[model samples]
Target: DMTQAASTGGMMEMPRASRGQAHLKLAEFAAKQLRGETRVASFSLNGWDTHSRQKRNLGAALERLSGCILALKQGVGPAVWDKTAVVAMTEFGRTVRENGTGGTDHGTGGTMVLAGGAIRGGRVYGRWPGLEEATLYNRRDLMPTGDVREVCAWIMRGITGTGISDLETKVFPGMQMAQDPGFLR
Candidate 1:
């Protein structure tokens, strides 16, 4: 139905011609999982390495990401949206300050965006380490205030009804998930 829906005059234009089709594919895959055809799915968005003119370069990436989110939500429909949880995360972050080349270097501390009817929206649940030069990691990167695994463990524990002990010990070995920043509703 997406091809037919796309034929409507009111549909949004593709942020980037090449990548837009992939967003549609993401929506299709999500629909399959919602219909009990799959248990899980994942997708990747490219072009985060902005080594020059970050304002311009990063916009395209963000737009494509947004496009994917919109397509997924629309494809799933409101009936299934209430049960979904879309977690968008980056493996790592970039430097706090722009580098000499008008871009950022790879560093620690990125973001994880959790969306859908299941998430507790409008709240940024993380310890904020201010932008003071001394507060930065190695004087270049934002200090990582929250453990990524803790968030992961929290989500898994909620979904599986698993105990904290198993989640911390078995699910994530050697990692003790202390703080539970509840992102799930």
Candidate 2:
């Protein structure tokens, strides 16, 4: 998938096995960490900035992201997977509409994906602010309907049984979290 984008710089080119190798590698590493010594693991994937040619750019990025997620699920195996909760988040959102170059610009109200057997899948969570022009953040990007920190806090609470008091003050200072969205199963 990434081979196409990488070899030709967003065009179909020769197949390259080495293209986007980090996805599966990191996934395998995450799985090993979970199986061995680590309880919480974090890794990152880049190239999400689509300032131009968004379709081609995002296609490869999303493909790699998908592969990484799949690799993580497979590598962790069912036993560990059942208890695992994986999250992938970006720092900010993209513009609501394609720009002059058919790409997106940086803005606010981004998203994160949460996965694991313990998660409540098959649905989109959080309140949506809608695509109407009036609702966009700065009238350009997606307006956040809820606090992202709350989502993370709730996930932490669901996994570690940490209390709201500490989560608000210690883990995430000055956060006033909402009631659980029931992401855990």
Best candidate, TM-score? 2
Q: Per-residue lDDT for 1-185 in model 2, tens only?
A: 32222212343222234555867776776676667645676667888999999999998888888888888889888998898887778888899899999999897888888888879898998778799999887889899877778888999899889999999999999999876789888
Worst 10 residues of 2 by lDDT: 1-10
Candidate 1 regions exceeding 4 Å error are 1-20
In model 1, which residue pairs have backbone atoms overlapping below 3 Å?
none
The candidate that wins on lDDT is 2
- lDDT, candidate 1, equals 0.72
Worst 10 residues of 1 by lDDT: 1-10
lDDT of 2 at 178: 79
lDDT of 1 by residue, 56-122 (tens): 9999888877877787777778866776677888888889888888888788878888887767789
The local distance difference test score of model 2 is 0.80
C-alpha lDDT score of every prediction, in listed order: 0.72, 0.80
Task: Give each prediction's root-mean-square deviation over alpha carbons.
Answer: 7.4, 8.4
Q: What is the lDDT of residue 59 in candidate 1?
A: 91
Off by over 4 Å in 2: 1-19
